[model samples]
Target: MAADGTFSPVPTGEKSPEGAIGPRSNTGQKGGAGALIDYCTVVLPESSIEDHGVTWLPNLIGQLFGTNGAIVVGSIRNKPWQFYSQSAVLLDREGEMVGRVGLGGNGSTICVSLSGAGCRWVTRWDNVAKAVERWRGKLSRVDVAYDDYDGECLDVHALRERAAQGDFASGGRPPMHRFLSDEGHGTGCTLYVGAKGHKELCVYEKGKQLGLKTSPWVRAEVRMYGKHTALPLDVLTRPLDYLRGAYSVLQEIITGFCTRIRTTRKAVEATGTAMVEWMHRQVGPAINLLREAFGASWADFAEVHIAREGHPGRFRGVAKGDRLAQLMREELCPS
Candidate 1:
């Protein structure tokens, strides 16, 4: 809404007109060192505008850039229309409002403009890469990867044969003991208890269809399909303690494995059941640890799943349960 009590429509699809305040500038980039100065001018449609809601933009900006770094400078209201400016005024960590983000247009179509100086000021003291990495870390699932062997790569059959001969842990590498094996898909899959007492499953598959003269390489991946927790950046940055917590949780799961798997099926069914049970037990304590570390805010965003009857069952983030179920199904039954 304009100051004169007239309703203005937000612009759609088109770029902000020249000389317009806070017009999108091409001089800035989205990430890296130049990210702070990068101006993003998006003319959203009615649907997008509604999706963002009135307060969402301000809140998001506040979260990304500290509250001191951004503020609502001015706002106007008319029937069914409201407008405000989110100025990136603070130029440094000291919290000084030295610049502004030009916000124009009205309810139907609005334009957000940023000056080159404003962009630079916004990014001057900001570590864009680290900030983005932190956000990504919050949204990412924790995965633990292990390298079974570092020497010459061996085919799945040869690897299994060597495992049968107890060759994997005889060297300086951590001693690994196999508890379950599955070859239902022609690929060799084995669950092992490492010397560190961590339980991991390795799937070895031979790549096919190389060039006429080239031999297909053997490929393998070690997976610890336990609890999937999207922890906050602060917790992730201090990984030593978090890892210790994880080790404790994994150790508990491994120690209780025998009691849980009293009755098992053939290779595939047995391995799947074990994996599912481990994941199920992994959720409670993992979520507790995350709640302790990141507080309740993370519960709203983190997706945790437990397995039921060899399939993924909801433990948290039920809104995304179906998607999580689909992903787990595909992973467990790749074919």
Candidate 2:
């Protein structure tokens, strides 16, 4: 209610109450850097405005208003700050007013939050295309924040918590994002969780930047899958009959293999920064299996390659008996 005898009740909803200062409306939206929203407010214990930072506002407003908004400056209770709308002001601790700032549109809508010494505003996008054009290049970085540490180390559970919080970098913050992976010695999905409320499964490869999506059917093989290696025929029986026994065994093995490969690929993509410990724990056995499989597939091709180096004749028959002896003799005899 206002100072006048007007009646006002708070807005209520499942996510947030109306008229209450919750987070931004786009708090969990996702898109490229240009559409990113980067704003932070450090609310003080007191009820008035204090000092604040302007570094994240420009990109933030650019995402919100496009490129037509403008900022106007003025004094508010003798506080120094910038305002996107003339009515909205960002205050400094010294109480000196700056100006109103926006993408410069005549009828742009905006959202604002006022705390002690800090203020944030999300101007509505009037010219989204123009805004994307004007601010896309200017926005650099993808800042990723994670969930609070609950007296636990960074692991899969922590990663799950981060995913629950949507902790991946968004709204053109900065590229320096962070995330946790499953710490348990088991196989699991690779995830990219946003801090401001976003999460996605990703296929990250080593020495890469972006992550890829994994096949929904594949899953990591952990200790729970047990150490008993089954023959190709054993897995084909009963409930394992997914494809009607027509190579169902192959399908399951391939799915399991793909899952492991995708997880490793994701680790490679993020260059292990996001899931290093998890990768280190799983990659060794995965690589060994790959090598063994590759070796078995091309076993006969090995002799053919050696003969192709100019042996001619019945190389296969002649090459078999003295292959090791010939190799050592050639090395010792030089040329």
Candidate 3:
């Protein structure tokens, strides 16, 4: 979409002061604070009714990011993506779309991905992690990056040489790397390790990419994918560690962190919350298959009203804490 122009910042004064906008942490061994998470895609399972609706994301963002900015949506295109539809843009305090939300996908899942701006806009990383835990969300992709303005500590050519020296070697099998350049087009060069399956590392010239040809700014990024593999939430807390662990070359460069081993997440018990996640994970595929083969009418399952917990904003039309009683008595219920 033609997303770039001027996005109006959500108005705030007494109710929410400018102080509500948190400060950003700088993380560079030299020049600037650039150690950061640049991209992330969080996947969440949806109950049959919760999966498809215009109001779902509009209702959820305030609670999810704790932002008072009103939600506005756009499109992920008219076509379905990863089987999801009705995608919305995530609102920052500036009212700009820093991320996207998708609903009505396979297994009735909702997928959310935040761009570099979104990751930086959300200051409370702990709250995000806590929300994911509370909602049983699985992070499908998380990218951690560190900038080297002087290119003193990290260099693409240096990394390439390290790869040749077997410094990037993992499990006695060195990561595959490929070098790509615009060839004097002033677009800068990139060195990719492991290149795009499960986990990868990327090194590039940041300044050149931003149109500053004389800049010494370089960036090294590590990307971890949880699609086919398990991703621990620790990456949210200790991103630097995970970044360094992506390669031995990185471990040697990014100092003060020594943990190179991958962490394992514990299996969740089939509790109510886990069951919600499990239903989408374990049972959702079957439901989706039936929906595809027959149709929504032909493929349906019964939902038992086991309990009533009043949590508003998590679902559409659920305001404050009063709607649980009404929802249980709604016509959608199989009374």
Candidate 4:
């Protein structure tokens, strides 16, 4: 979108002051005019539904009555609204439930579901409830309660700390008494989700060690735990993060000159004219995907950090007292 070709500082005076600010104009193409790409956005509570509507919302007025954004929007339409799972909670190494600021809906749910499914599938959570109960009893006999924590409210830094402690080798594994059915009897239960130790073959780096060990029950060496969690080896985050970061950086760099060329209408006109062309050449693929996959919600990913120009970070940060934190407590973690 073209920014209104004005770079005046927002006036602070209660009343309009004459010539309070200098005239500055920076113009670029007013509308996006480039090939579309598919992209996925990590939903955040603060993420604007209106912005997402641009790409996903059904068009009330149009010839086809729909566009690529609508189709892409439909893909993730059934995503759960809660940020955290009411039934499940994550624990860090210290055994103190990690605190986060967001809900466990969207990406977090997917990650948990996938992790649980990947680790234990055929067993099924519903069926496994009995097993979990049995295990809890065994562990309780040993004086342990099944630990619970949620991912939605934790900050990335906090998650990192917890992850470091949760690993089996790093002294992070939950107490045997907490997770096992019977430490002495070993008859009550075991960590059975569905299929135990299914390795996600999509992303595995043979050389780089992600720094964690896996269960002996795991068949193939390529497991998805430790560093291989959700982060893809080649791509980072959801793939959208890299593209968005690059786009934002490039946009900033290009717009930085807007101030210099504000007075030069010709330059403004030239840049505006080239904007579409530049975007097409550089970010067209990612943008198109973002629109297709996530629609206007792409903005939610705008602030996501990119470790490399091409890779996106898997985690989003939550500070101490953000609304997301409150939501996590109210919905996922009750005091």
Best by TM-score: 3
Ranking by lDDT: 3, 1, 2, 4
TM-score of each: 0.21, 0.17, 0.61, 0.16
TM-score of 1: 0.21
How far is 160's C-alpha from truth in model 1 (Å)?
3.2
lDDT of 2 by residue, 305-328 (tens): 423543322222112234424543
Model 4 lDDT tens row, 1-335: 01332111122231212221211211121101110011111122213322334222223111111122211112223233434433222222222222111233543322112121111111122222232232221100000010111112212233223324542121223312122233333122233111112211111111111111111111001112222122221111111111112212111211111111111222222223334445687888877787688778775665463222421111111112243234334433346
Q: What is the C-alpha local distance difference test score of each model? A: 0.31, 0.27, 0.56, 0.22
Once superposed on the true structure, which residue ranges of model 3 sit more than 4 Å away at CA?
Answer: 1-34, 48-55, 70-72, 75-78, 91-97, 182-186, 256-335
The list of candidate 1 runs beyond 4 A from truth reads 1-152, 161-201, 206-215, 224-335
Which lDDT value does model 1 have at 190? 40
lDDT of 1 by residue, 187-273 (tens): 334444342212233433322211111223322322212123323332212211222223222211111101001111112232344
Report the lDDT tens digits of candidate 3 across residue range 2-106.
023111111222111223211122222111122466788878777522533424565566555544553444644655555686666665544556778877656
